[model samples]
Target: MNIYIITGTSSGIGGAIARHLVDAREGVITISRRENIPLSRIAKTNSSFFRHYAFDLTQTGKIPELMEYIFTSFKEVKLNGIALVNNAGTIDPIGPSGKLDVSGIEAHLKTNLVAPAILINEFIRLSRPLKVSKSILNISSGAAHKPYAGWSNYCASKAGLDMLTQSIAMEQSAEEYPVRIISLAPGIVETSMQQKIRATSAEQFPMQKKFADLYKNQGLSQPDTVASGIIPIIFSDKPESGTFSDLRYL
Candidate 1:
């Protein structure tokens, strides 16, 4: 049986991914800040092979304990552990770079960068020891590759994450771990995060027009489309490590 782990299953792409996995009868272990309400709906629709783990990933210290529990609970049938989706993220008030709060930056770093690294570390350690092939799929952003105003902290964190994924993939080649790491820019999707961006004030958000124009003209990819393309890659034997792809590119 293939086992999958996912973060931010509370909503948006995370929830959509979980639902897609269910429809395919792929087993998944989902983690999120709150109980996954949409996952429950998915459970009602397709009940087998899904488990929910509600926890705040921002508390980086708790990750070790969580990993221990997962390993211990699933030791018997763990060979098929396939992918870890680092999908959890946050983008608070958009503002001028100088006006951003220190705490807000730190919060984004922890959730967007540090926590994912921690999870990747634990998953690799567990995978090697347990002898399972695995992959780490990090949901990065276009901001990581292209600069956008009023999103300094988010951009920085994502850029760092993008590099981290590349570095990990390179390291995997050298070390030959039975795992691959991919950093994907999921492009713009219609999510609550977009709603937050649209609500920012003009004074604080100078580049709001760029975002508005993107959404208005380009529209947004449905979460299911991304999930469909990504899920196959997660299970593929092709060398996806160190590659950065977007929905359009896929």
Candidate 2:
């Protein structure tokens, strides 16, 4: 069985990835702040293969507990492949560095940076005993590579995440059983995050017009389309770890 644990699946890119996995006949487990209506329906229809956990990601302390539950619950089953996707992220509090709220920046830092790193570490430790192939997908952003005006928090958090992935990839490079970890930047998908960008004032988010133009000109990529394309990469042998890849470049 190809088992997957994914975060921020209530909607947007994360939700699409979970749906894609299910469609491919892979086992899926979703963790989100709120219960996903569509996923709950899937669970009812495919009870044996689907699971959902409605918990807050900002509560980073609960991550280990959540991972332990998954490990214990599926202990007896022989696994063919295991995947952990740290896809949950926030792009709000859009403004210049001095104008943005410190509280909001703190929240963004925790959700985007801290949570994924912890999950990646815990997954490596737990999967050490399993013989199955393992992979981790860090849903990254273009902000990781280039800075955007009025997006100090978002840019800094993503850059930090990219570095974290790079460091861990090297550490596990020569392990007896290596886990492939890739930080993927899925590029301009049409999701709630885009909507938030479109709604922001030009002064607060200088690039607001660019985002609005994308929406108006039908330039946004569909979340499901991108999800379908990226999910297959996890099962492929290409793209060595510690690499930052973009779907557009793929």
Name the best candidate (by TM-score): 2
Candidates in order, TM-scores: namely 0.92, 0.97
Q: Which regions in candidate 2 have their CA more than 4 angstroms from the true location?
A: none
Q: How many backbone clashes does candidate 1 have?
A: 0
lDDT of model 1 at residue 21? 84
lDDT of 2 by residue, 1-250 (tens): 8899999999998899998787666788889988788766875676547778888878888889889888876776668989999999999789988888888988898899888888888999999988778999898888988989888888999898889888988998888778988888998999998999999999998889999999999999998999988888886776778889998888
Report the error of model 2 at residue 165, Å.
Answer: 1.0
- Candidate 2 backbone collisions, by pair: none
